[model samples]
Target chain A: MLKIEGLTAEIDGKQILKGLDLEVPAGEVHAIMGPNGAGKSTLSYVLSGREGYEITGGSVTFHGKDLLAMEPEERAASGLFLAFQYPVELPGVGNATFLRTALNAIRRQRGEPELDAMQFLKLARSRMKELSMPEDMLKRGVNVGFSGGEKKRNEVLQMALLNPSLAILDETDSGLDIDALKIVSEGVNALRGPGFSALVITHYQRLLNYIVPDRVHVLVNGRIAKSGGKELALELEAHGYAEVAA
Target chain B: MNAMTSNAEAFLRRAEALATPAWVGALRRQGVEALARSGLPNRRVEAYRYTDLTPVARAEFGAAPKALARPELPAQRGRARMVFVDGVLRADLSTLPPRPLSDAAPLLGTVENSATAPVAALNAALAEDGMFLDIPAGENAGLIELVSIVTEGAGPIAFHPRHVVRLGEGASVTILETCEGPDGVGYLHNPVFEVVVAEGATCAHTRIQREGQGAYFLSSIHARIAAGGTYDNFTLNAGAKLARNEIHSALEGPKAACHMNGAQLVGQGQLADTTTFLHHAAPDCASRQTYKSVLTGNGRGVFQGKILVAQVAQRTDGYQMNQALLLSEDAEMDAKPQLEIYADDVKCSHGATIGALDENQLFYLRSRGIPEKAARAMLVQAFLTEAVDGVADETCRAALDEAVMGWWQGVAA
Candidate 1:
């Protein structure tokens, strides 16, 4: 349920995503593989509506709506979620409190009743258990002093709670160990359903082994240079991006 | 021809009208004389260089109105209550422990020894009533609350509420001082407080300044700690046309400790200043000071802090840091942190930083679907949270945190 056509984007006057076109239909998981400076992360940032990026040209549609026109919070309310590669550390905002505020903000935007503190606590505690995160983490500041793996797991925990219609994982596998990668992948795989869609961006194919993709797109030099099946990820892991880009 | 000339004369005339104790009146005269000798401190004066009180000096000021009804404490309970209306104490509206103090005499016993500083003397000369608490030697669980409120309009009003907290050996106590104002005509509030911690004692003091926007507020806190004593002070300044909080502490004995932390948010023409001076007078004393200021619109913030160590104060450890975040192009912040150490064995350092919101941090939060305003507010709050979190008392911490959030909402709106 996501479409990107001629998505040309530049940051600081330097073009990163030049005329990139890709689509992920409902219920499918898409993986974008690329090397350094290939604009894989740029697509995720642009899709998330971050400021400072000049969208030179192109349009993005999510669930039949103009994704490029919506504000970041509007995109979030409309069921678009981005799992940042390097999770930010909010020193004074508790993890659970932050999640609750975000959840209510989105819910309010959707015209749903906000969850009370007690209600949120119960729901969050249960979800934390599912992700193997300690109850103490919920009380601490978001991602502050957390291990890299813990931060990644915290992201998945948020994904579980938000249950967005479309999820964008920008190198969620980076800095994560094999165990963390599996846990994160499993968390994503568990949310896969007919109503959900995902665009997973990564440099290596190791993560795909856990969360297999329905389609593979190789982004090179700011555009999607190759499109193939799930096997394409395995082939790249063996041969690397030089062969594909060349 | 200077503003201080007429202002000082007006202050003296008002001081003459009050039927103060002879000694108290004499103290006020000394303050007036000091003002005459050193007309409102100018840029040449090191401490007043960044913060010019000339504007306040130029304004015609009159005596504060009589005491008003005490403010009702929200259901939230604390240790003790001391009420001040205008700049005078309203004992009728205050509550204190019934039994007479045995460990330390009533506060009146120590009143005469209090200093005659310009602000302190002015408060003492005009103050009608106030609370004095003493924690007996080895006493446990002592708590005090000072509630200061402005009720009426009487030109520029100033209130000086003196607090002498004497913690006996090994005693502990927490003091919460909240400054508020009624929705009356705008006025001024200047309060002075003093705290003393005895050997092996611990004192936690918190000050919350939430005066009305039209009010001019100034507060000064002076503390002295003995050997092995600990003093912790936290201040939150949210309201006022011009608000200044000054904290001065002296570590008098070996191993005495002091922690000073404050957060201030000023918006739209508001001026808030936090000036602190910490003296390490004895060997092996440790002191730390951290302050954060957030300014928006044409708001201005000033932070001036200094750490001083004496030659005999060998092995002293002192650290001071001040940071400011300017939220708007028009917003301005002045930060100066100074360190003067005479003992080669002393360890003292100071740092000051002025910056705008971190772009990377902003983008990181906004990308998560949080609104730009909400994201910026979150980051700003986070920046100040460290100082607030350092408060030892949870209730006080929660109250200060709420005050911070309230200020943010008001300014952000």
Candidate 2:
């Protein structure tokens, strides 16, 4: 469902992704493991069409459409979802309102009928129950003063509402406790099917324990050094990044 | 004399020729004298430091400005309305409130004028007609609307409308004042509002100013609250070439509460200002002030607020905050917040913030499938709603919310 070739990108005149190539076929989950400054977050941002990044070379295709040429919102409308590394706090924008707007936008683009307030609330409440998030969280501003766990849960909530074709989880497990990690993994696992694909970006094998990946790609610098199965993550965990990187 | 002073004198002389009662005529004379003394405020005055009124003074308004046509006004339900066209009350279109105590008494010039508020004195002297609303003891007046409209006129003209609102003990009332005019007509609408909240009484005042692009709006509100009374006020300065809203509220009795909140949206070449003063003269009183501004193009906004706690006002709590959002590099915001506490037991604080839209927040919203323009409008509306919600009445709040949306649409256009 997603493909990239020679994806060379830079920020602030310095290259971050140098001719990197990757692919995630339909009905599979792939994990990208990299050390500090390995351009893990940069890859997510570039794929999401965030500003401040200059794409110098190569191309990216999602569902057979050129992703690089589209605006961020257009990319989203085309079923590209990026769970940010740091979800911003919108002090006055309510979570429910934000989610409803996003849902309606995509629904309109896909020619689907929009949901009214009652229908939307019913769907949101059901999803919140599955993720163990209380319904009151929807009334507050988007992640205004949420706890670390609450923020991660909120992201999963958005993912559940959006049901994108491809989901990019950018370190969704960094600050989460073990229980939160399990709950978040369950939320992702519930969405697993032939129609859905996800690229889990993490640095630790701990998260991999909860959401086992079909393919594990070890990234050294800007390029993927190796690709293997779940065992690869265990191997890297035993031996620090230095041994494998070399 | 200079051209501005001479012109002001000429306009005042023309006002004297209007058909007015003896007291009204005398008041117009006093207004002329006050303007003659001040000659229109300049930057030299500390109160007018950030906003210069020289342009308003220099404009060549017609000596005998008349209403060219009837003004268009929307009908709002659940509220008695009083319509004023070119500063003259239209009794044919007005519905006076129920159980009005001041209906038989003369309400004009009831609020004593002072040298400090020269503009208000001028408004009192020149006001063509005024509104007097009285809520009897223990009664609740659902909502009252005062609509002031200025139709398209030939040249620059000025009008003053005085309004007096009084509440008996344990009474409650909500008032919505809307001002609008045709574009390109240079009219100055100067209005003075006098409010008295008796013991255990409550009042909510919401003022919306959306004059013409070439219009000038200057408004003054003087509110005095008695023991166990509450006064809540909100203002939206969303239009006009130049507009200033000055509000002064004094807590005359113990345990009185006052809240002053406002939002301003200024577009190209527009200037809007909100100056407020909260006087805590009695003990155990509380006051709160919050204002927000959104500026684009060459728009400029100013907020000057002060809180004074008298020595006898022990256990006073006062809080003030002003925030500005600048959407363009050319837009500017000037904020000055001050607090004076004569009582050591008082708790008082003031804060101001001026910033552009958060780039991170913008990216987050856009990345969620929301368009850039939609995201911006959402953020601006949210910024203003933080203060707009302070209005107690839900219907009035919704009306203000719609006004903000209308302003956004105009900005987009």
Candidate 3:
């Protein structure tokens, strides 16, 4: 469902991702484990089409369409979602309002009828319940004062609402506690069916245990150095990144 | 000697020929004299430094003629609406409870004589008709809508409306005031409003100015809060080629509280200014001022606010904040926040921030699939929600919030 070949990108003329290549076929979940400065976040940001990242050379295709050529919102309309590592706090912007705008924009692009206020609230409240999120979060500003777990849960709630085909989780479990990790993992696992895919980026092996991946890849210095099954994550954790990377 | 000055002077001459009581004539004469002395506010003047009225100095605008139709602007329901057209109260289109009023001639002279801004003095001298409301003790007047409309006219004209509101002890009232003008007419709307909040009274006022693109608006508001009284004022300036909204509040009695909040949105050659002064005369009074401005396409926004704590006003707490969001690189914002505390025991703080819409916030919204234009508009509205939320009246706040959306739809394009 997602393809990246020789992805070379830089930020402010400083090279971050150099010739990184990875892929996640349809209906599969893959986990990318890497230590700090391993370009895990860079790869996710590049896939999401965030500005300030200069693509030196690369090609990213989603469902056979060129993803890099699309604008950020266009990519989103094309069913590409990125759960940011650190969610932004939008003061005065209610969480439901933000979600509705996004949902309507995508729905309009897809030639679907727009959801009114009541329809949106009903859909959002159910999804929020599935994620074990409180209803009041919908009334507050977008992640303005949310706790770490709440923020991560909000990201998952958005992912569920957008119902994207490909979601790139960028270090989403770094700040979450154990209970939050299980709920977030369940949220992701629930989306693991036909026509759905994800690239779970994480620094530790703890997250992979909850959302067991179909494949495990270790990224080192902006490139995939090793690819294995779920056991690889345990090996890397027990042996440490220094030993496995060397 | 200039055309603008002469035009203002000619307006007084016209008002003089159509005179009435002696007190009104004398007040008009003093206003004309004061305006002739000062002319239009120049950049050299301390209070008018950032805003330059020189650009419109050549164009001439005379006193407006009789209005033909009433303007229909958005208003919240269940409020008493008082309509005024070209400074003349339209009783045919107004809804007000029966309340006796003092002689307008004397009130006009009093406010005109004590006015500080020369333009206000000009309004007093040439003032024609206005609004008067007196709420007795312990009564809730609910929300009163004072809507002023400048109907389509043949030529450039000016109008001044002197509005006076008095709330007796323990009285409570909420006012939703709006002013609008014709789209293509060049005119001047100089209005003066005064409110007296008696001891233990609560008076909340919301003023909105959406003048025509070819018009100029200059207004002044003076509010006095007595012992244990509370005064809240918010103004939204969204139109006019040039506009200035000046507000002054004096807390005369102990334990009084006052809130001065404003929001301005200017685009292209439009200019909007909000200046406020809060005076704490008695002990243990608190005042807060928050003003927000959004400027784009070479528009200019000016904010000048000052808080004074008198010597005897010990334990005074005053806070002021002014923030601006510039959408275009050429847009400019000038903020001057001052605090003059004569009392030894006081807590005062003021801050100003000038910046573009946060890029990260924009990206966050867009990444969620909101188009760039819609995302930017949402962010701008959120930025302004700070001051709009300051409106204590829920229905009035909802009305203003909808107004912001309506404005964003037009201006964001």
Candidate 4:
């Protein structure tokens, strides 16, 4: 469902993703583990089509379409989702309202009828209950004054509502408590089926124990140096990436 | 100085013909003389540095227009109605609430002292007709709407519609002052509103300015709140070639509170200014002020606010904030927030910020499948919602919200 070949990206004229290649077929989850400066976040940003990153030499294809040429919104419309590590606080834009706008924008692009306020409220309320999120959060500004764990859960909640074909989880487990991690993992696992794919990026092997990725790849200095199965995550966790990359 | 010679003389001559009370006439002469000496504030004056009055000063002044023949609008219902045309009151179109003068006398009792404000003096001197609303002691009126409609031809027209609202002890009311004009007309509207809230009284005064683009509007609302009284006001400016709104409030009694909030949306070379002065005179009074402006194209916005705490006003709490968003590089914003406190045990603070849209927020919205322009518009709207929500009246707040959105549409297009 997704493929990246020779992806060379730089930020502020400093190279980050140098000649990177990755592939994730449908109905599977691929885990990308790396050291602190492994360009894990950069890969997600590039794939999500964020600006200010110069893609000097690379090709990213999603579902047979050139993802590199599309705008961020176009990528989202084409079913690409990024769960940010730090969700931005948009004051005065209600949480529910923001979600509804995003949902409808994607729906409009897919030639689906937009949901009205009542219908959206119903759908959102039910989802909030399932995710164990408080209803009051929907009334407040988007991510404003939210706890770290709450922000992660809110991101997952959005992914569930958006139901994107391919999801990129960038440090979703970094600031989460054990309970929040479990809840987020459960949420992702529930959506695991045919036609669903995800690139789970993390700094540790903790999240992998819950989601249990089908493949593990270690990224160091902007390039994936090693690849293996689920046991590789545990191996790296026990021995560390310093020896593995060497 | 050259423009003031002939213009001042003509205005004085017109004022001499009015049959105003002797005291009021003298005040008018004083104002005209002061204006003559000042000669239409220029850029040399720090307060008017960013705003030039050359265009307004050069326009020839004319007599107030006759009252329009249309029925009163539904929005103008309730509250006393005062109409002005070309700097004069159209008494035929106004309705005064019945009252006992001896029992329900005005709080200030008609400007007995000489005035320092030239324009206010001029308004009071050549005054036409005004409304006096005296809320009986311990009474509450939901909302009072004051509609100031300007209808003039090519020449400049000025009107001073004086409003004296006195809230008796424990009385409450919300006053909405709206300034509007006929479409496609070029005119000037100068209005003054004075309010007094008595002990334990509460008053919320809101002003909406949506005049014709060719119109030059200047308005001043001077309010005085007594001990234990509360005053909340919000002003929205969206129309006019150049518009200025000045609000001055004095908390004279202990435990009094005042909240002054305003928002101005300018587009396509438009100019709008919101100036506010808050004074704490008694111990334990509190005051807060917030003003936000959104400018697009070559539009310009100005905000000047000051909070003053007197020596006896101990334990005073005052806060003021002003923020501006410039949608285009050509757009300009001038903000000045000042505080003057003579009391030792007072807490006072002020802050000002001016910038373009947030790029990070823009990217976040765009990445969610929202178009760039729509995302920018949403952010701008959110910036304005802060000040608009400060208005206490729901209907009036909604109306201002719609007006801001409409202005955004015109500017974005």
Candidate 5:
């Protein structure tokens, strides 16, 4: 479902992704593990069409469409979702309004019917309950004063609601507690299907234990250095990325 | 200066010929003298630096039309209303008639200063008719609506309507004042309001200025709060080619409180200004001011707010914040917040922020599949929420919200 070939990129005149090649085919989740400066986040940002990154070389395509040529909203409408590491706070925009607006926008772009306020609330409540998020979360401003776990769960709720074909999870477990981790992992695990794909980027092998990827690749100096099955995550966890990458 | 002088001279001639009560006539003469001396304020004037009155001076406005059609009014949101067309009271459309300003002479010109506020002097000089409400002691007046509609005529028309609301001791009232007209009319609507909050009384005043595209809406408000009294004022400036809403509020007695908040949505070919002067004269008083401006498509917005705490006003608490959002590269905003304090023990703080919509926030919204335009509107609305939500009256707040929505739709179109 997704492909990247020699995806070299740079920010502010400094090369970050030297030469990266990776793929996550239809119905499977691929895990990318690396150390602090492995350019894991950079890869996700580049795929999501974020600004300030210059694609110096290589190409990326999603479902045979050149993803780099599309705007961020177009990417989202075309079934691309990026669960941010640090969610932004919108002080006065209600969480529900933001979700509904996003849902309807994607629906409109995809030539589908839009949900009204009441219908949206019903859908949001059911999703929130599944994620163990409080109903009051919908009434508050978008992630305003939300706790770390709450923010991660909110991201997961959005992922579930949008139901994207491919979601890039960037450090979703960084600040989450064990319970939150389990819930979040379950949320992602539930969406696992033949038509669903995801690129899980993380610095630790902890998240992989819950979602259990189909493939694990070690990213070092902006390129894939090693690829293996789910057992690779345990191997790296027992040893270290330095040994694994070498 | 010469052009302004001629303009004032013509108005003075018109006022001198009018037959009215002796006191009213004297007030008009003083207004004419003041306007003749200051001429219409230009860029040189400190208060008028950001808002030039050249357009008003250049246009030769005739007296308000005698016969005219009553424009469609907004849905009634107040218990009683007084409707004025071109500054002339339309008794046929008014549900509650007002007493003449003659009975409220002592309170009429007591609160506002004509020297600094030339528009107040202008209104005093030429105001033909206006609403005068006198709430009795301990009486609850509920909600009152003051509607002013400026209709187009054969030529540019100018009318200065004077309004006064005096609440007796322990009385309370809410006033929703709206000014609207058809689009693309170069008429002038200058209004002045004098509000007196007696001891232990409360008065909440809201003004929505949705004038026509080419109209000049210059308004002045003067309010005085007595001991244990409270005064709240909010203004929404959505329409008008050139608009200025100036307010002067004084907390005159111990434990008096005042709150002034406003939002200005200025679009292309529009200039909106909100200037306020707050005075904490007595001990243990408090005051708060928040003003928000959103400028789009080369529009201009100005906010000049000053707070003064006297030596006797010990323990005064004053806070002022003014923020602006520029949606286009050509849009501009000018904000000046001043604090003059003589009481060393008082607490006063003021802050100002002016910039484009935050890029990170914009990108975050767009990444969620929301279009760029809708995302921008949402951000702007969020930016304006604080000031608009400060309105204590539910009906007034709803009306302001509707007007903001209307303005947004207009901009989007």
Candidate 6:
């Protein structure tokens, strides 16, 4: 579903993600495990078409379309979603409005009919019920004054609504407790299908246990150095990134 | 004579021709004299530095034509509705006719000091007709809709409508006031409001100014609150080529409170200014002010807010915040927040923020599949929602929200 070749990116004068290559075929969930400052977040940001990052060289393609050539919104409309590590707080924007706007925008881009307000609320409520989220969460401002876990759950809720083909989970489990971790993992696992794929980016192996990945890749010094099965996560957890990376 | 002198003379001539009671004539004389002294305020005046009224001084305006047809009015939701056209109360269109100014002569020109307020002085000099509502003690007067429309005219016309709202002790009322003018007409709509909130009473006033693109709107509101009284005011300034909304709220007795909030949406070639002054004169009084401005194209926005606490006003609490979002690089915003405290035991804080839309927030929205234009509009609406939410009345809030949405659609187009 996604492919990258010699992807090199930088912010300002400093370089990050130096000539990294990776790929996730259709229906496979992959995990990118690395230590601090290992270009995990940069890779996710570069893939999502965030500004301020200069693409020095290389290319990324999603579903046979050049991802780097698209704008952020176009990237999103093309079924690329990035769950931000630190979800932004929109002070006065209600969560329901944001969700519906996003869903309708993508649906319009895909040549589908848009849902009305009542239709949207009904769909959102059932999704929230499955995720064990409160109905009041829709009434509040988007991520404004939300708890750490609540923000992550809100991200998962958005993922469920948008139903993207590929989602980049960027350290979404950092601030979540154990119970939240399971719910978020279950949310991701529920979306596991032949048409869905994800790049679960994390620093630790804690999230890997809940949402088991088909492949585990160790990213070190801006490059993916090793690839293995699920046992690789256990190895890294037992030994640590330093030993496993070497 | 100079342009300013001619402008003042024209209004003075109109004021002198009105055959009213001796006290009313004296008040008109005071107003004309005040205008003659100050003329049109320039940058030299500290209070009027950001806004220049030279256009008003240079223009020659005629009286309103009596045959002009009234435009459509907003849906009224209140105990009664009053419609005014060209500063003349349209008794045929009004369901509740206010008492004549001669009846409220004692309270008409007593709330504000017209000598220092040029626009209020101008309004006073040429003022003819407006609303005068007097709620009796302990009476709960429901919402009242006051609509002012400046009909299409042959030439540029100027009108000054004077209003008075006096709530007796323990009385309460909510006012939804709107001012609109015909497009392509270069008229002037200068209105003055004097409000008195008696002891233990509450008064909520929401104003919406949607003047024509060629119109000039200059409004002044002076309010006084007695002990245990609360005065809440909210304004939405969305239209007019040049507009200035000035408000002065004074908490006179102990435990009095005042709240002022407003939003201004200024587009190309438009200039909107909101200046406010809050005076905490009694002990344990409180006041809050929040204003937001969104400027696009070559629009300009100015905000000047000041809070003053007197020495006798111990334990006074006051807060003021003014924020602006500039959509274009050519757009400009000038914010000046001042706090003067003479009391030792007072809490007064003020803050101002002026900048473009936050990039992080914009990207967050865009990354969620919202188009760039839609994302920017959503962010701007979010920025303005904070101030609009301050209105206590839901109907008034809905009106403001509709106006805001209409403005956003215009801007987006």
Kindly list the per-residue Cα lDDT of model 4 for residues A1-246, writing each as its tens digit: 899999999999999999998999998899999988889999999999888899999799999999999989889999999999888889978898889999999999889999999999999988888789999999999899999998988988888888888999999999888999999999888788997899999998999989999999999988889999999999999899999877
Please identify model 6 stretches exceeding 4 Å from their true place.
Answer: A238-246, B1-7, B16-23
Looking at candidate 6, what is the lDDT of residue A33?
Answer: 94
Please give, for residues A79-130, the per-residue lDDT of candidate 5 as tens digits: 9999999988999999999999999999999999999999999999999989
TM-scores, one per candidate: 0.91, 0.95, 0.94, 0.93, 0.96, 0.96
lDDT of each: 0.80, 0.85, 0.84, 0.80, 0.89, 0.89
Across A128-212, the per-residue lDDT of candidate 1 in tens digits comes to 8878889999899989999999999999998888889999999999999998888888889999999989999999898999989
Measured with C-alpha atoms, the lDDT of residue A142 in candidate 2 is: 95
Interface RMSD of the predictions, in order shown? 1.7, 0.7, 0.6, 0.8, 0.7, 0.6
How much is A172 displaced in model 3, in angstroms?
1.2
Q: How many steric overlaps does candidate 2 have?
A: 0
DockQ for model 5 equals 0.80
Displacement of the residue B212 alpha carbon in candidate 2, Å: 1.5
Instruction: Show where candidate 4 strays beyond 4 Å.
Output: B1-10, B17-23, B65-114, B151-155, B182-185
**Which wins on lDDT, candidate 1 or candidate 3?**
3
If you score just chain A, what TM-score does every candidate get? 0.98, 0.98, 0.98, 0.98, 0.99, 0.99
lDDT by residue for model 1 (B1-413), tens = 25444545555566567666543445455555555545555565677777666665566665655535444555434765766666666567667652322222233324322334444444544443445577788997656777877764444566555556778899998888888775333566766666778999999988888888877776667788999999999988888888878888899999999999988888887889898888889999999999999989999999999888989899998898998999899999988888888989977878988999887777666656567898888888889888898997888988888888888877777
Clash pairs for candidate 6: none
Where does model 2 exceed 4 Å of error? B1-7, B15-22, B25-30, B63-72, B97-116, B153-155
- DockQ-derived CAPRI band for the predicted complex in model 3: high
Candidate 6 structure quality by residue, lDDT tens digits, B1-413: 14445546666777778766664665677788888877778776788898998788777788667685666766777779999877678888888866776776788778857424898988878777678888899999998989988776635788888888999999999999988877777888898999999999999999999999888999999999999999999999988999999999999999999999999999998999999989899999989899999999999999999888999999999999999999999999999899899999988888989999889899898888999999998999899989988887898999899999998999888
Which window of ten consecutive residues has the lowest lDDT sum in model 4 chain B?
B100-109
Ranking by lDDT: 6, 5, 2, 3, 4, 1
